[model samples]
Target chain A: MNDYRITTYEPRHRGAVVEFQQMLWQGGAAGNSAYLDWKFGANPYLDDRYVTLAWQESELVGMLGVFGSCWEVDGHGRVMLPCLADTVVAPAHRGGPLFGRMLEWLVERLRADEVPWLLDFGDQPAGPAMLMSGWTAVGPWPVAVAEREVLGSGEGEWSAREAVRGSRSGATITPVATSLPEMPALAAETRSRGSVRVVRDEEYFRWRSRNPLARYFHLVAEEQGTVGYLIAHRTAVDTDDGPTPTTIVECEALDDDVWRDLVEAAVATLPGKVVTMWVRDLAPAREQSLASLGLSPTRPSGRLSQDIHLPKLVMRSTGVVDDAGPLATLTSPDVWDMRGVSGRGWR
Target chain B: MSGSHDVQDVARTVLDCLRNKLFLDGVTADTHLIESGLIDSVGFIRMFVVLEEEFGIEVTARDLSLERFQNVGSISRFVIEKLAEGGGSDKPAEAVRA
Candidate 1:
């Protein structure tokens, strides 16, 4: 029975999609519903129409969700594009052309819609398959980590929130409930250094803070004004050692000293926890700052082994761009400001 | 580390892993593990772990190409080459178990 049909997602398929996601998420139906809603249902750029589904008759056998995002190319102001995520296929349909077929359909749809290209932060299990499906491999990006031994369970004596609230080293760190009003201005003030990055506008920050799967914390640094800000989130990941408490230091200030202070305060909050942040193409000053803070680069073996597989960004053209277009810029690993680029459902 | 003996041993181990660890029956040395749907992405990782543990060879980034892992024969050859290059280590196998 190799008769698999491909179709775009509709409202009627919501229940099936949620149910199908349990195989991938294992977060139960309610959790899956909330994640789906946050990622696509309430997205500012794209709608549910971009979600593609595969079926064997009426059974929902596979799905590939394409969500919208905006990028700021150096010369270009803002370019909206789709990113592939939340891919799942039924066990009964394993090891077949179903994945390739769904991808082919999605690419065709993106081409029809005139999208220039699509991106995926492909994990270890998904990396090779994506490469085989024609996605260009741009990275096995490096990540930096700082870990400390906790005397006891819980936050111990120091509180992450309290640490930031207390001032140190010229700048004051203040924890905010959401993105600071000065975030856009602060982001604008920081130079991109000729890289394509996610547009960190007010709308993007507000939307990013609503991710239900992650508990986000925002900290703003002020010396004279809003010099910098940091966003970190805590999530539990199932590692080889069981559920590990992990804090992703998602984004921070561009200034080395301010960035160091922000990170120090953030790490102080979650004492003894494993803290990680992207370090690919990091500036020398920032790299030194992280090292001074006791964080070291954790390089992946690229074998997709037991150790954490290096996160690779994969892309494929939709045939909408010429040779001299933005595709060349996007393909270069050095051209991405990777902070906070970790996709939805990163756990 | 005799070449022919090593190849045979690697092939046997690869086939055993596919059938036992990955639960894929009838996987032969020449079977197209990838194209035949016997090994998907997750399966590929699991298989890599078995190879690393069984051979005590550190699988590096350079060894990650799809062509190198397409089938039992290819995987066996890759393992033999790695073993020949003194890739074996004294590190405990438990350290790399996933």
Candidate 2:
């Protein structure tokens, strides 16, 4: 612990950046410079404010990403906390102190800016680490996703095969059964929306555009060369099929059947089964492009972070302390008594 | 009969306006608007302001949550329901208002 000092890549340490990312990802599949390019490219939207690296003398021991800003949220309201992610500690340095040290440093940085909250997806093992560092888990967004592509034919082995194919690198992306009668209209509508498209280098595009843990496919519609639409590869349907390969539709500004085209494109690319996307509550139209598909009234689930003492935001469910059990007895006769750690999605 | 539907409408309108004005996406019934990664605590207060601006609804700190407005369906339901109930409660609309 005494041996390490934290640093950032603001000045652009190409070699160090590559090294840090290599260490952070830690696998041949770590997806190097191409990955960094994507992460940086996404900075405009992701806000990519904090990417602090921990160095023990000359060795990069860990890194943390802190993205904080204000954004309008659909269902909840205006959100202004920093999103914390990409926390990776070198396996050799995984003792109790490093995580806390990184967070303390982060808290200092955020506090300096007067930012209120911090949010993240936690690895269960890191629970105690955050608690020791002063992060109380208020709750988690209720939804999560996974990625896969189907191929070969209508809803059959081919579809499943395609899902596998779509996930692998260099695999051809084919649209699976997106040829719906409504596709033309869907594509037109997606095109009409005119959302700024997300552009990334291929590897970075695939990795940055996906759910970090899930690695699902993220497709967006592009106009000319600028991107304008996006499609998440996770689809939620009436049934909970096992290990389902889903593409969720996160954003799109096109007018044409954006849903139909992306879905169709997926169906075609996969070369099998019905390619589908998971959307929260009820919706989509496509044909233009997946990523360019319009946003539904539905909000994708994820947690928000905030300074505990904000004027209006108060903790009623009791996650402030490190208690795993529900602090208060719930009186909801209708809902089940859900109790767990503070970050439990049901809290 | 009227309570649930009214809350749902206001919730939908709020969600729609946020997406339109603020560039938010992936909203749904079970989506925890407040807790979701979308907003921070301060952002939460601004949401109330937006609601007021867009729907003419006055929300307070106490009027927040599932017990009152659980989902978008319930949120809209709660807003309209509570509004219909005539805003006479002493409790604040915490979820919607700061």
How much of the real interface does each model capture, measured as fnat?
Answer: 0.36, 0.00
In the range A1-347, model 1's lDDT, one tens digit per residue, is 67999999988898999899987766578877887888888788888787999999999999998888888887666888788888888888867788888888889988898888988874635565666556776767666677776422232222234534424456888766667778776776766655687777888877777776665667788877777787766542233133344455454564777877887876665433576677665567777677667677765444546443556777888887667866566877778876557643243
Residue runs of model 2 more than 4 Å from their true location after superposition: A23-31, A45-49, A68-70, A73-81, A122-124, A131-133, A138-230, A233-347, B1-98
Q: For residue A184, what is the lDDT in candidate 2? A: 26
Whole-model alpha-carbon lDDT for candidate 1: 0.71
Interface RMSD of each: 5.1, 14.1
lDDT of candidate 2 over A1-347, digit per residue (tens): 55778766564554666666555443223354545544443444445455778888877777776543233322333334455555677787764456657777766666566554455533433442243234444332222222334332334333243322222122233322222223223333432211111122232233333322223333444334212233334321212233444334343333334334444444444332333333221233331133332322222111121112211111112133223322221112111111111111100
lDDT of 2 by residue, B34-53 (tens): 44555433444455456545
The collision pairs in model 1 are A160-A269
Give interface RMSD (Å), model 2.
Answer: 14.1
- Kindly report, for each predicted structure in the order presented, the TM-score of its chain A compared with the true chain A: 0.87, 0.47
Worst 10 residues of 1 chain B by lDDT: B89-98
| Docking quality category of candidate 1 according to DockQ thresholds | acceptable
